[model samples]
Target: MAFTICYAGFRSGFFTIDHIHTVKQLIEKCHEYNRPLAVTFIDYEKVFDSIEHWAVFHALYHYDLDSLVENFNDLQRTLQQLYDACMWVGLKMNMSKTKVMANIYNVTNPSATVGSEMLEIVDLKTRLYNQCVLPTMTWTLTQEAVYRMRVAQRTMERVMLGIKLIDRVTNDQIRSRTKVKDVGNRITKLNWS
Candidate 1:
């Protein structure tokens, strides 16, 4: 349920340097506070086509959330309504044809699915060190940077896989299985190495 803030004033792109700087500062502050942090991008430009239109209206009516929250009761009521709406929508969600959150109770699909997939892949890679790939002596500053680079490369590949999968799905083509298998191969290669 990510929203893309697009100001028509800026023609170059959706986000600017200020946005990055603000996010960087926020992440830095989270680290300083010893809070677990995660950054993810979600695209909802074409979400309407995939969603049940009536369900969105149903959610809006049931939740009746305030644009501004005043109290706990309001929050509870709003949450209940929202949950009901999501449940109605999810029941109709095509599992075989539609991709939802892979391993969560939340709405991880709707385009943020890529972020979850990448996070899962990163978690998998991180486990390698726990399995004795990186000893204390070798897990110094330089090795940590190299490990980060590898993670970044794998993340990029996973992102590419998401793009390819989405394209295939949208185009109504016959390459879905092949695309998934290709991503699986890449994941296997990463794990084996």
Candidate 2:
């Protein structure tokens, strides 16, 4: 069974899976090492309980991991080992949906596999961020959530304009383009006099 960290139903405390939490962890570890640490965040789909316990334990014991940090070579090797472990345990990885995000000086694309398909870290993040993270963060419709959604929409609009997805952009254009409600941006009827 997955713990609170893996499943919403079991959530007990503040989630450490968020980017802010991950960034804090990275900074803390980097300070401990006394050098800037290049870090990557990997996410898997349906990761709740699909993995076999024995396989997980075996992989953990087999690998000499001092905090799951990986260099390029290590990441490749670990990817191979992960595939092998999944094969032995009858577990399948969702590579297309899996994501890897990194904050580093420079990064070459890293790769992972799912059922003979190879997926790149950067592209995986682009797809999954739009599909998963953005929606989950925006769905609550609270003041903060609504504000974030608008900010994201604006950023996306800039990207769209940069890529020539739109001829030009205006506030009206942005408002018409997205269904996201700009909840806190408007004055209420009581305040309008």
Candidate 3:
């Protein structure tokens, strides 16, 4: 069974950045040691609403995973076992959304299958770029949007400082008094990080 970290609602202290860093370190270590590493990402369709809690607990209690999976066959077997368990629990795995990533030094292609479908293999770099960078690249702020945001910020600042446009206050003076970061600069910093 796959365990996912949920960051919604009141959950605290578990961040996605920690997972990304851990994965990066694992990949680096595997590359440095010239070890073959294959990672499978599984996605379940409608897990929360479809699956029953009692069935989930029963599946977890019955499932036995003892040894480390060393190769593709073992991985495939493990996946099949997981698929069976999930099927028993009324949870459906989305085959199209599942993907496997392996190290570049691996000579043989890692073929992992669930039921009759073969999972797609993706390059780590491509996957990372697509997930992390592509969205940032595609997020464009229009001039009108930026102007509106700035105006809103100024209005908020004026309300906080109890000042109006007739007060003849400069934006720099208001910004210095308010000590708040500019929206544009904040966005730039967020994108950089």
Candidate 4:
């Protein structure tokens, strides 16, 4: 293999750690340049299982690239090889749910992003105010995504109460009836217990 994935510090076995690290590094690098970074979170179907094992790695390690065509030839060839190897072992990649999102962050102009096929560029600054910038209390917010979540919670609550949403049942009324603790309260109770 011409390219080898650095497995030196991957003992933690957590891909999210890489995600977080990537995001942090992106933030730092973009902050320096005052440029926005877009991150596409791909939904690979069982890639880790196929690539992480010693048997598959050995297969890919020996697979040589004799013929090449266009861009990303190595990636294309390697993927085909991996697919063949996995099929031989009775495993397959779900190419349908495999979303190839290029990036999510919008810096200056969302339109300025690269390789944009069908990515919807949402304003992270506005939506992430609750989780990224403000306190968790503030995350129970009346903002765009937050409002939708609260509305969903209320709708579910109303459904449980057998009440029509058009009947003008307030969220407070549903809360009073259900007496269900919110997630934060539940967490606090668990900690205390």
TM-score of each: 0.25, 0.40, 0.53, 0.32
Candidate 4 lowest-lDDT run of ten: 99-108
Query: What tens digits encode model 4's per-residue C-alpha lDDT throughout 1-193?
Result: 3335433234345455665786678667865664534443334367566555554445545564322222233434444665566555545556544322122222223332112233344334334433443344333333455555555556655654557978998878777655444534433444522
- The 10-residue segment of model 3 with minimum total lDDT is 1-10
TM-score, cand. 2: 0.40
Ordered by lDDT, highest first, the candidates read 3, 2, 4, 1
Taken over the whole model, the C-alpha lDDT of each candidate is 0.38, 0.50, 0.69, 0.46
Error of 1 at 10 (Å): 5.1
Prediction 4 TM-score vs. true: 0.32
Worst-scoring 10-residue span by lDDT in model 1: 99-108
**Winning candidate number (lDDT):** 3
Clashes per prediction?
A: 0, 0, 0, 5
Cα lDDT tens digits for candidate 3, 1-193 = 3344532222366677776687788878877787777788889898777976657655655786422466778888988988898898888889999988775555444588898999997656445533554344323477666566667777766765557899999999887655555666655566632
**Candidate 4 — which residues are off by over 4 angstroms?**
1-19, 46-117, 130-193
* Native-to-model Cα distance after best TM-score fit, residue 174 in candidate 4, in Å: 35
CA lDDT for candidate 2: 0.50
Best by TM-score: 3
Q: How far out, in Å, is residue 119 in model 2?
A: 2.3
Among all windows of ten consecutive residues in candidate 2, which has the lowest summed lDDT? 184-193
Candidate 4, 188: how far from true, in Å?
31
